[model samples]
Target: MNNNTPNNNLTIESLWQFSLQYYSMREIKEACLNLQNHFHGNVNLLLALKWLDEHRLTFPSSQWPQVIQSLGRTEALLLHFRELRRKSKQHLPESLYRDSLQFELQLERQQQADIIDIIHRIELSKVEAPHLVDDYCHQLGAEHLAVIFNKQRL
Candidate 1:
């Protein structure tokens, strides 16, 4: 867990790429959605944590609140569209639903960018990667997801 890598590779675009590749997996995608739907967890934040874990970097604990706050607006919008997409499935045409889903994905990417911005502003330390993700999942009473995430790590 203490395998810290150089931070040279850490970037806004890198995080988005990591998230896309990671979330495309069926198991990780389902686990993330489970945490989001049942535990009020932010999937972007979860992915950010995982990305940080992969990079062997983590920000200070004090910055956690700010990190959460950064995505508030976007998270709300995501949830709204998620609900709309779910509820409108019966009435909306498939094309419209696909558009809505695509927009939601865009919002998700924006959220990852926002997260990386916050992380960039904070002082990060080299530490065991799983600690932050573990703490967050435990805080949400979803330790199972922490396990899932760790197991799914590349």
Candidate 2:
């Protein structure tokens, strides 16, 4: 949906816009890039976790694997875009490389939207407030996943 469209309540588009805005913050961008490069973190999932944490909602422990499974091909899509972008930088003219960079970014945005669609399908299981972020990481299969969200110190 166009982000300009009005909604009575928060929707995936809002969350996606929040992700775009929040992830653009210098600190968050650096941290997210570190997580992506060093720890195989999915930035989209991290943004959704932040949104869910803010709203005081979480998936049940039983459903963590479901969340990971629902990520579908986001990782693969990112890999594809990254490869294309990298190759374009090496082989294409500066103008084409710049255009490829923009297209790659758009692909990344669409990938985020796809992940949000999966997240919207989940049934909210409310939980204790402060623990939601950690809970999300644990569900992702490591206590350290929370480090990316900064719910715990490394």
Candidate 3:
């Protein structure tokens, strides 16, 4: 039902306008909630609370945190989700790459499954020695996967 009646304090138009005006998604939702409470009988605002989050939201890098938090939505939908998308590859699984890269780069024992996987993908015959690892790195550079071998000196 619509709440464009004379006494209604909130409207769909205002909600959209509020988002444009504020850097914080939380602030926008807070403002909407306050107006909803002030009027107490507006079904339009109530309906909005259900669907405002289903849509995708991206923001300027400067406003991302506020845009994310103020929107009163899950980070998976509007925030960190982009990182998930960026790390995805058509030929490789995202979770496997992130987990393997993290484990492979960590400072620990000389062995890890991640290291083995990296070696296997690059081919042992192509790289012949420890010093040649840098050459292997150059080859892997094309894939933007060189960050995996940092091995963290510290």
Best model per TM-score:
1
Between prediction 1 and prediction 2, the one with superior TM-score is: 1
> RMSD per prediction, one decimal?
3.1, 5.5, 27.4
**1-154: candidate 2 lDDT, tens digit per residue:** 2333222344667777777787777777877776567666677777777776766566666666767775676668777778778866777899988887787677676766775665566666554664655665564455664665664221
Ranking by lDDT: 1, 2, 3
Once superposed on the true structure, which residue ranges of model 1 sit more than 4 Å away at CA? 1-7
TM-scores of the candidates in the order shown? 0.90, 0.74, 0.18
lDDT of each: 0.83, 0.66, 0.30
Residue 109's lDDT in candidate 2:
69
Candidate numbers, best TM-score first, in rank order: 1, 2, 3
For candidate 1, lDDT tens digit of each residue in 88-150?
999988999888889888988888878877776777778754487887899899998898898
Q: How many residue pairs clash in each candidate at the backbone level?
A: 0, 0, 4
Q: Which stretches of candidate 3 lie over 4 Å from their true place?
A: 1-7, 24-74, 85-154
Range of the 10 consecutive residues with the lowest summed lDDT in candidate 2 = 1-10
lDDT of 3 at 34: 46
